[model samples]
Target: MVEAQAPLKHGGWITFPFFIATMAGLTLAAGGWNNNVIVYLIEEFNIKNIEAAQIANIINGCVNLFPVVAAIFADSFLGSFGVIVISSSLSLLGITLLTLTAMLDPLKPPSCETGSSFCQNPSKPQLFVLYTSLALASLGAAGTRFTLATMGADQFNNSTHQGIFFNWHFFTFYAATLVSVVGIIYVESNVSWGLGFGLCVLANLVGLVVFVLGKRYYRLLKPQGSPYTALARVVVAAFRKRKELQSSNSQDYYDETQKGQRNIVGTTPSNKFKFLNRAALVTEGDTNLDGTIKRPWNLCTLQQVEDLKALIKISPLWSTGILLCTPIAIQISLIVLQALAMDRHLGSHFQIPAGSMIVFVMITTSIALAIIDRFLIPMWQKLFGRSPTPLQRIGLGHILTVSSMAISALVESRRLDSARSHKLYGNSAVPMSALWLVPQLVLVGAAEAFHFPGQVSLYYQEFPKSLKSTAAAMVAVFIGIAFYLGTAVVDLFRKTTGWLPNGINDGRMDNVYWVLTVIGIVNFGYYLICACLYKYQNVEKAELNDTNSG
Candidate 1:
């Protein structure tokens, strides 16, 4: 009996290399196309600068958003490994199509030379193929990125190991993105778009092959039906029993499947969301003779009730991320436009790719992650006598984000001055160096190093066991929403103010940065409030002591 109950040792540090390699390959493939897509549209598809930014924003929104749906599917039906395999194949197919478009002249719009007055738009058939390719690639990238995070973390039993994995996971992701943005974007810009996209196809294939090779060593979890369904039942059951008196006795609640399983000590259904207790109250006809629920919609288990409450409690904190990401997303898109309008020369022979300016953020983030993991955390523990919590790290992220926005405003102000002084307008490059954008980018990267892994750690640790996949994808969800919101904000600015004109040299881009700074400041205050009010639902005391110890 003891041997039968003993756990199988299927996953450990042994799976680490495969997961890291898989992440590096897939992230490089995704970044290769995604990073340079705006430029691709403008150069190949004859899209206007502002219009291309909007499309890029929308594409980015979709790429991040689809992960949530993929996570749900992984949690509900297909497991993470299966979803990743399918998504990787889809990515390969999509990138291959993208490569063909770059290679076949007929598939592309007529080339519009620099300073040309006239440009031709892509045909309807061309647009259809382009959109289809983008959709598939976005969906494929979405499914693998966050789902892989969850699956990789699942291989570990210790919280410390899991935390370390998340740190290195994001490090690998950013480092791969840096490589793609620099190397692949250079190939697309200086060499051939066909060759660049062809490389993405190869990367995707390699990632898929490497992941499949580690199948036997993975800690595979089967789908235990949809956890979302259980959450919905909790809400419905609570609504149905709204008028019922809440019970104080722990035994009055129906603890189905696992007896005495309480989220809070000495409280079966946590007191914070007391009204939800009625959902698990053992009322008449709520259960059968065998103690199973008769009608799930009318009566849920105590664990289910607690799960819903946990989500509700964390929602405000989750929402803070939306605003945190919004300004960053908008800035990222606008920086490309800024880079295009500024001097991009490095020495004399080499000119930096406008689209690759964001790679500084990736480079800084990768370096920061390594430094934070190896030196910062250990020093912090020794000095503070304890490791920093996720909320503390997130608070620091907010502060740095606000600072970055301020810096962006100042830099944009200088760039606009230089542009106006030189009388540079209508897509002409300003005399000022594009390197002025580096400080803000560096700060933003540092902010991400703090918040991204912190949020991943918090969500994974706090979320219910059944919703682990969804938890891993929650950061992606907020980032997607932020990108969408960023699009709306930019659109609003375009319509209401002359601040973000097509040619920013003819507009007040500094004003846009100032507005984002204000938004960041306001959002930071809200995040502080949310962080203070929230309590961890699933974090164990032992885990706190062991955090980042690995």
Candidate 2:
């Protein structure tokens, strides 16, 4: 069976690049809205730092669950095709609604008298319309991301194609980021805010259309495994196996069904109760009364569940890691918005847009991931004899995160000094170019290259077939929890300090960066600990003897 499947599932080599392109498109089309939320909220609602961050937190946290929910519906009742179609259609409505809201009620005016746009706030109607629109956009992002990645994976046929898709996932991520970077930095910053969001909205609609157009090339998979169910089966099987090994009871071995009251058909219990009878089952023995051979019980055994249970449990580690690692993306929103608001040179001439650094990371990293997987992986494998596993890649990524955070801490510490120095001169805080954040941003992109690949592969690899979607959902859940936890941390700090002078008590953006830097370092340590303690799934070889594995 393994031999047969191996020959059939070989994917294409060149198709990898296009796969990455598709992945980039899918990723950017999915989550790009996250970066702009802080600025969007502040501008639209005239909210303070904590309030805006809270909203951003909510959006990120909620977006993940939608996919899990959709995946559930797809697996159980609606087929994958039906689920995708409904989601895509809803996606168009959500994106268009955001565009309409932004255009109809602009979040910011073109010009301000003092040239400090934060000085003037929007009216209530303007605020309400913008937020409502953003909420719609978030809705679109959730459903859109759910189908997009899985759909992109559809382009590859395991049997007919080569290994092109192995790398294509990364490529697709960059392609989407290309649009996001351009939209946020150039389109949104240079044109109107509405245009930036509208750009993604349009891009998403295109993505939806592309999916609909290519439905034929894609293979629809049947969702038979539920990870939660698989895990339960494993636990039960393990205990039963243990009991048999201990010779606890001859009848207790596989006769668990017989332990309960099971009436035969036409008995006192009623005909319906016959369905529950295990005593009348085709009992296995050396030979039956009809001289038939002995047989093993099916489905309700311990060994059957092991393959899936391992994946379900191991997935949480990667998921937890992603949750902790990715929400730093919020820095693009919360930190950048605060930086721009307080930067002395934030006027038109010296202005550095909030989303530009995130754009920089997206553009640069997308290119790098293409190079890393295609060009770098092979070279390293040849040189090292054995290449790094996904787990190894993730471990290395934490090192990069530590460095990025350290850089942020240093830049922020200096910004504080600069502010104080300018205060002495009776100026607005001393202005620094947003360029200071470049190192951190660049490192983040590199870290992502290391982190996302290993983590996602580990996820798909570990779980049983029935638990695939559940494994996917568990990953999403971990990330969601991490984002929510990060939000809570920020909110707690704000409530404690913001009421005091300068909110954080340091009186400026520099202080916030200082705190984030310290927290990032702590998170780095925590992640390392988690990684060290984590037990990985042992790879199982295909066994034709077992009907299930076969």
Candidate 3:
């Protein structure tokens, strides 16, 4: 299977540098604009602070949501290589438009004077250009991120190498993002937005060129049609044969998909979700004389039934991740608002960009990944006779997520107290240093280090082989959903309480963090229950430790 899929001459270590370079350029370009969009909307488009945060969250939701669609296209039609090429081109076009918006005075509203309550909004034409640019760039980014990971993983036949690739994949991802958050955001904040966006355009062009240059080295996979249709057929067949008697004999079940060669034979389905086994009962007239199914929707292969079962079983654990990520999303958006209202000076020379506060999260996550991949996993293997499992890592992430939110609540409380003491209100910067916000950001970063890659590795390892790209994309999909849900959460606070207002200093931002902390705690408890109940579907216990524990 390995040789047939990727001829030895085509894939392996030779493709690594190309893939890594492409990922670095693309991620840097994406982070350049995405990281500072809230500030752009506020400073250039004259949007309100809270409304800008909401818009940022919505944009994030779209960016993440597009990955799943991209994944589907990669798995069903374009393949990862083709998708990357097209998406990278689109990204280039989008960033060029964005640069123009930053350069042209007519494309933005007039800047508001300090301490003014009134600010003119961007004209309709300006907004149209802005949103169109954002949409194209976001769509392009969504296509590349996880689909690229899947493509990289496809280069290796060994599961261990694939796991290592995933580790480095994210490390590189966060590291590039760190650079953009610090460098590009500093330029946007301290210098000119036009210059900053121009740099992004250049990065996007380079990334696209580098990716296309590696075409020959890639071991591109052919699309396998839509895996969703196969899964759907399983459900339809199972429902059609719901009343059929159960078959205990292995041969009675249809495993014809594996009939051709080797030592494989018909296999009995597991006891769990056994009701679905009716789909593969091999009843009369189900198969023709040559053994093909006469009625496609009335019968399915055992493998198909098992694939659907795998998805169904793991769904509970998957859902816990949504709530787990929601708090982080909310915290991230609010952190920018907090930074804007606090003293951000580093010594006397410079003030940190409010948007760049997220750099701390990226830095810590990258450092954490390095430690986990090198020291921690290795040390655990020597002491405990096994490395930590993905579920264990994700469990730790859940705990840290809650801890981070608690710390955020505490920090926000102190900031609020300082604001009250100083009579800071309505865009007045508090005397407190923004450095106080670092602790919570660090914790959130550490939490992401554990869960984000863990979730990706888990899905890739467990999902059916035909859905590899989709498996890699599941994490992005949930994170996207979480961002949308985070927006709703913010709106809920706005509608129901005085927690979030246009001037955060004048409102109860601390209460918002406290509420989020409580939500995190409850969600963590639910995650514990789900994790405890879940079982590994594809890899054996020992194999999981060997391949994915890192």
Which candidate leads in TM-score?
Answer: 3
lDDT of 2 at 202: 64
Which candidate would rank higher by TM-score, 2 or 3? 3
Worst 10 residues of 3 by lDDT: 256-265
Q: Please give, for residues 164-234, the per-residue lDDT of candidate 3 as tens digits.
A: 88778877887889889999989998999999998888888888888788878888788776788788898
Q: lDDT per residue, candidate 2, 422-533, as tens digits? A: 6532113346766777788888778777876667666666666555544555556666666677667666655776521322214554455556566666656665665565
lDDT of each: 0.85, 0.54, 0.85
Mind giving the per-residue lDDT tens digits that candidate 1 earns over 1-550? 0011113587789899999999999999999999999889878888778778888898899989998888778777887888999998888888888888899998888887743468788899998888888878988998897889888988888999998998799878877898999999999989999999999999888989999999888888876566888899988888999999887887778776455232223346778788888888778987777667788899888778888888888898899999999999999999998898899999988999988999889778878888998999999999978778888888889999989999999999999888889888877889889999999999999999999988988897888876775776789889999999999999999999998876778889899889999999999888887876676667667556344321
Please, what is the TM-score per model?
Answer: 0.90, 0.71, 0.91
In model 1, which range of ten residues has the least summed lDDT? 1-10
Q: Which of the two, 1 or 2, has more TM-score?
A: 1
TM-score ranking, high to low:
3, 1, 2
Candidate 2 lDDT at 32 equals 50
Which model is ahead, 2 or 3, in terms of lDDT?
Answer: 3
